[model samples]
Target: MVTGDLLMAARAGDGESFRALVEPHRRELHVHCYRMLGSVQDAEDMVQETLMAAWRGFDGYAGRASVRSWLYRIATNRCLNALRDGARRPRAGATFGVTPPPPTRLVEPNSLQPYPDSLLDGVPDIAPGPEARVERREAISLAFVTATQSLPPRQRAVLVLRDVLGFRAAEVAEMLDTTEESVTSALKRARSRMPRERPARARGTEELALAAAFADAMERGDVPAMVALLTDDAWLTMPPAPQEYQGRQVIGEFMRVVAFRDGARRYRLIATSANGQPAFAAYGFDRGDPVGHPRGVLVLTIEGDRISVITRFENSAMSCFGLPGTLEGSDHRDGV
Candidate 1:
């Protein structure tokens, strides 16, 4: 059935029709909520709220516009509501009273369900068309998303709707209930205040090649070469664990001495994306035997041709990334 017909059923209190109408958009909306609210925990909460609000108010949804657009109206409002309630904690690095300890390798990764890229499988590719500007992907990286943590909530909402998701000015105006001019000005300010990006220094599928090279380097435990693949100021941070390490000196030392410093570890990629940028689950293990099993799931972020960040997440993000328990030297020759 068409979306409009489904909405009519949903409005008539048919929960299954409403579920069918909303299911396709769930993962993307979750990603949208995640972009709007930096904390994964908070994003999950807001999505739940968005769904509940949508279901309870289905009867009031006017059919003048697409159901998708109306749902966004509800979701963005839910996020804005959460923001206005003042529930988020500010970044601890510069703005807070006590800087928390950095994330350790022993930490557990967030328990959030991984969204399959297959969401884009059947839907039209609304993400930056491959032909779009390069910065489009850069703007979606975790570092960029983390940097956006500093924006005022409303500005953050507008930017995500307009830039990240590729919503038009008029559509965003309807979503936010603001003038298109106001949205434009806010986006301008957002771009201005966003993290300063170095021109993407590396070229020619740098991220993919870098991921492969970095996997090789880590497998060989050649800290120097792995360090070479990293940007000078490269970092590794795992979400749900607030510890962020900066600079090659500190991060390289940690990777060399603590994480991969001693073991002959192997790796593989479960292809994935994080914070809207290129990502993978790099599974690690001590030996070629399938027994000692899958170890760490690492997420990489590339900048200019160098890997600017690598979050070696703890736990089943490895499986979530579709990687197998790896031997220190092999990935079962399964291609990503």
Candidate 2:
């Protein structure tokens, strides 16, 4: 077969043929590792390890399974090993100089990072085809990814492979080096932990309208108008800092004391999308600078017409989100 010939050529030290065989699956595999590890940098490292292992073990590849499946097997095992070693979990709050409030019952994924839409250019939009049961967008949402972090490592892998990626039970078992019965058992527990449906969030024109109104209020320091757009139980969190503010009263206090206390700081918000949600790249001006420097990235979780959660990440991560380090001119706004 053509693929067998290519594999043979690749093993014979033909670098071009090897790349031709593996290049197509690179992005998808990276996304898979991101879901497992919850960090983009970790995912990138895992992908390199997977490919290197494949290249070194080429002789053991009997061509019984497709190259894609083989690569996934390698990657999955690598991630599992990393998890077992505790080498990749989020650091403690004290390490970041954060004093976390009493632990709430709600599960929060630590060290959560945003996935840029630009990196998703060539990735296929996963939909419920005859083979796949879950929509691609739901699988990649920030909420969903955070929820998976609560599950045990094996259960997480089973749920993602079975439901998100649409891999059959037998296929998943083979990948994990387990029996189908074990895979089914793990999947049952995983599904029970997952919500019956993805959480409802504003979409399309409604989402655009909300984001615009929210940005406008922040720019003008309109506290009441900003408060009007939040759900009663809205939550605000800035990761790497364990502080979380919930409920309208507490959030308003946060806005008044921390954000708008010194008066409105000049900001420019450029629209972007992350984790299948609307996000903005925020740029703040120094006293007399003509242009603004990156402040942070804000990702919103909307429930119905009101925003439910605001997840803000540090400005140091702006580069990964495909945002420029500086914005020029007095006014820079991009309509969503």
Query: How do the predictions measure up, each by TM-score?
Result: 0.70, 0.89
lDDT per residue for candidate 1 within 1-336, as digits (tens), equals 877678778999999999998877776676677667755556668878889998998898877766777777888888888778866644322121233334334333332223334333433445542322325445545666666666887788777777676677888898888899999999889878886655464554766677777766765667788888878888777554555677777776667545653465455545566544455565545445553345445667676778887765555445444555543445453334
Clashes of each: 6, 0
Candidate 2 stretches with Cα past 4 Å from truth are 92-109, 125-131, 286-291, 328-336
Per TM-score, the best of the predicted structures is: 2
TM-score of 2: 0.89
Q: What is the lDDT of residue 322 in candidate 2?
A: 68
Q: Determine the backbone clash count of candidate 2.
A: 0
* RMSD each, Å: 6.2, 3.0
- For candidate 1, the per-residue lDDT at 136 reads 47
lDDT of each: 0.64, 0.79
Best by lDDT: 2
